[model samples]
Target: MLNTGLLELHSDCQNCFGLCCAALPFAASSDFAIDKNAGQPCPNLRNDFRCGIHTELRAKGFRGCTVYDCFGAGQKVSNLTYGGRDWLQAPETAGQMFEVFPVMRQLHELLWYLREALAFRGAESLHDSLKLMLEQTLMLTTLSPEELLKLEVHIHRAEVNELLLRASELARSTARGQLNPAPKRQKNYGRGADLIGAKLRQADLRCVSLRGAYLIAADLSGADLRHADLIGADLRDTNLSGADLRDSLFLTQAQLQAAKGDLAAQLPGSLQYPEHWSVKL
Candidate 1:
């Protein structure tokens, strides 16, 4: 399969059946304005399977929806798995479709990471293995709903994470060699650290691994995050004004959407500046 095909793994809301809004349950919390039950269509969901308040979700206190990404699983199940049929069209199949959507979503997320791992030139030695894993993941995405529900996705994810860790190490090691020598004290390693509301402004985080770190409400303004791996890092309310994240790895749109930043924050090309961000540097 073509590597470019992997790009389609991103969400295509127009082609989706609003599976997330319908299948996932949410409570009235800081993220959502109202409680929604599993398999129930969200109140804002239109008959066309589009959000009635899509442009104003944040303003309406539905920020949770804005940060959610199904990794293209919605369309894959709506069109391919269910053959373009929807819950309304085929009520009998609705239950199984919802069950299968989350499973497919997990598989698609793995595909996203595997594709990124394959693109890491620093991990060239692991290219063959990465490609093999990508192929295996692609095969899983094509499985029927029955097969997908039977999948132990966590087992495969653990295996892929092993290779991804190696890739991360190689990439960071190479980046470190290229950076100017600095005092050892400036080095920061906060992998899986509880850094919520921690003061980290202007910190030297270059070539660091903040994977799965809880950075919510952390002050990261002007911090050097070049080549940092931010996969699964909680960035909500983190002040990123002027932070240098130009080459950070595994930074997704959802993470960026959840965080607060200004125009001066340098992001990788794969991501776009949030429109709500302040223009001030």
Candidate 2:
């Protein structure tokens, strides 16, 4: 298996420009009660790039802000990539930074899963391909600012399709036969089942009905969860590292985003990495 420990690298956020304050948007929801547009600095953002009402964001109707994470993307681009520059003084650099930020974020997210995939013993068969992909992705980070901004990630994704498919097979195989399909039963009955601390590592749980199940602190590492239905499931502190959650049903953006996963972590394909994690190594 590939070593994923090295992919846990992070940037010092204190020196960052608080890009998350500017890059992300908010909608009126349980987490965020206000609507903010992209590229607009959050009202609570101070001149020093700290949230003025950080401690009271939840009380002040901005609970979403407290849970949001840039996955260290804010720091990586705001600090190392740009040498601590900001759009404030250098307005001309704003466009470039904005374009590069998302790209870098995606790369970092990919790094998270690639690293995690390598760490899974069940994925050993595809280690060589994983290594190549990881190295190539590492090289992308070194591309020129213009090149990085203009990178055609779709092409790279296409190139790795085979590897991803193979890795999925390997990862899925590890979870063989753990979960049985339940009869098409009434929804209200399964509202709150106790699944905490279940030894469900590497289990194939795709398309399983787990709505409103108490999955708190479940050992779900390396589980194949593509297209599974997980609406209203309590997933606090769940160990979902390296688990495939792409296309999983009923997983709202708010729930998945609020859930915690390490950099070198994986989520359903439908989910995006929380901005706070630096890289998914």
Candidate 3:
């Protein structure tokens, strides 16, 4: 029921808590050559609460810092939940702030998907279903911190899955049931090509043209998409988890944050690795 076209439903990080910097941890790896623990501030975090090395994070050996997105949870939790108080100015709120960060992050992730689900005209048949889910997700935002943190996300996600499958069925009908059908050979695309819900996991989609493509809910997890051209692409809810997106051109930070990516994922030079992943530590 929110305005879906303008991405208005998503978070604006500039107005956020800088929660991504404070809540997540980092380690010495290709992405970040440090061993900062969870909930600790980055050394480069500035007095004004911005990353001091944001522009040169890669050269500074913090590559993962360039690719991370909190889906606007950072700003909302920082400003709304804490009443515009930064942790440095109110040190006593540290524990509570960290605890609330992940809850808001999870809520924002659902919002990203719900917003995407509402945007697909191909899924208009399932709009009512998506509308209900969106309403439920919006209600979660108003819950107390304890309730929000204790919330079971998989239950709501399961409900969304049923509707998503039906939406895929409707979208696929237009694609003639061929998911990820090879694009034309000469750097071009035909009018009304459908790629919605296609399984592109680990696919080699380098240097390809995807103008105005419908990529809603497409599983791009683990795909090597270096240098791919994605101009005017509809990428709502397309998974990029575990995908190698290094050097992918013209992909915006807003787009990357709108999709899901875990620790196993690779990102552009601008983002960093997620500190919350439970790898074999």
Best candidate (score: TM-score)? 1
Supply the global lDDT for candidate 1: 0.86
For model 3, state the Cα shift of residue 234 in Å: 18
What TM-score would candidate 1 get against the native? Answer: 0.95
Report how far residue 126 has shifted in candidate 1, in Å. 0.7
Task: Note the Cα lDDT for every prediction shown.
Answer: 0.86, 0.66, 0.65
Error of 1 at 10 (Å): 1.6
lDDT of 3 by residue, 1-64 (tens): 5434323334465676567777888899876979887799878877677778877786888867
Give residue 104's lDDT in candidate 2 (0 to 100).
75
Q: In candidate 1, what residue range of length 10 has the lowest lDDT sum?
A: 182-191
User: Residue 46 of candidate 2: its Cα lDDT?
Assistant: 87
Model 1 agreement with the true structure over 1-281: per-residue lDDT tens digits: 74455446789999988899999999999999999998888989998899999999999999988888888888988888888998988889888888999999988887888777776658899999988898898788888989999999999989988888898889878777777874145545567889999899998888788999999999999999888889889999889999999888788888888889899999988888877676764
Off by over 4 Å in 2: 1-12, 158-162, 175-281
**Each model's Cα RMSD:** 1.7, 9.8, 11.0
Q: Which stretches of candidate 3 lie over 4 Å from their true place?
A: 1-11, 177-281
Worst 10 residues of 2 by lDDT: 182-191
TM-score of each: 0.95, 0.61, 0.62
